[model samples]
Target: MALRLLLDSADPSAWAEWLPTGLFRGVTTNPTLLRRAAQPCNLEHLAELTARALELGAEELHLQAWGADLLGCGRALAQLAPGRIWVKLPITRAGAAAARALIAEGCPVTFTACYEPAQVLLAVALGADYIAPYLGRISDLGRDGHANLTRMQRIVESVRRVDPDGPGDRPDASPPLRLLVASLRSPNDLALLAAEGLDTFTISPDIATALFAVEPTLAAAAQFERDAEDT
Candidate 1:
């Protein structure tokens, strides 16, 4: 499972459509995605969504904590499924504080909204299970998102070498702190980033749809069906 993929969406409809395909390892969501899906950002709603995702075979569900009490929200979110839930927090001071507390409790934490290369250091220090960097958003900021992400990957590997006992170690130990790339605008981003050794990604449903929409593949599949019917 070097190349891991997760559905980056909040809509249950999206989960119902894609999760059964088994193309996605899990799903990731945030406050913005929740609003876009017309869902309230609260523990009650999140709990329901978590149940649905897990029921649909989501091995991991990332739910971002929100509002003033980040720590409180994070704590509650982690309780949704314990080992299966990965509480997402932004790469800010306050978010870091909440993340640190959550990490100490052995909660799976993922640092989201990452833009800079140095932020990987913080994630490594906190022993987060994942750090999500928005690729398209970085490019929107007029920077080379691909290059920035490459650097983040390097830093993660470098730290792993320094501290072999760190995240993503032996199977019996804790899970690795993978770089979960997000905000992908196109399917090609996956290939480009994966080529750079960034294996984990969370793509929107649109991108997931696009991945299966290759004209040649569709034509071949149609031909195969026709041939089978004729025979």
Candidate 2:
């Protein structure tokens, strides 16, 4: 499968125009993003945004829950988009319990705010659909971000070998839960994670534009055009 590209935008109004550009595979929003949009973080607004994403052909919609009230959040999520939504919760015990419950009930859950490989292992144990690690946040704190992701990948593989029916179960031989690297600061960050075989990466439009703006890339394209004309 192609590496999924999700746009982490705060404004819904911006998405209506941006979705047509064909770069984004999905959209992810948090309470902060909604606050930036000048909207309340309620179920109604979330459902509306989810519907808009669906209309824009987004394959997934990531919605976050801020506190320890996972049951309430899960209920609210069920009401707002149901199967189409991936409820994002922190990588805490409460979050894991809620994620397990939701996933058992067939609701996709994304375990967010992950920092360590242990957190990712817990997410897999809870049958999470996605585990989001903040690469930039980790790197900012003087940690080797890619090393952590690599460690998590190894843990996943080991789990699969020990007990195939355990946290790393491959029901149809599919890989374990996807690792979605978050908190991207630049297009280079996305490229770094993509090269590491990450399942997905969320980026801002500014960074997304930068991915195709490297001077060497432009020069190579220009050289190709000149060579074609000569031929």
lDDT (Cα, tens digit) per residue for candidate 1, span 72-174: 9999999999999999999999999999999889998999999999999999888888999999999999999999999999998898788877766766667
Per-prediction TM-score to the true structure, in the order listed: 0.95, 0.85
* Prediction 2 global C-alpha lDDT: 0.78
Any runs in candidate 1 off by more than 4 Å, and if so which? 168-173
The predictions' CA RMSDs to the true structure, in order, are 1.5, 3.0
Q: Tens-digit lDDT track for model 2 on 1-231?
A: 367778887577667756777778778888987887796788777777888888887777888876668867876876577677788888887887787787777788888888988887787677787888888889888999877777776776677678857654555632467788788888777666667666577887777778779999999999999999999
lDDT (Cα) of model 1: 0.92
TM-score: model 2 vs. ground truth: 0.85
The 0-to-1 C-alpha lDDT of every candidate, in the order given, reads 0.92, 0.78
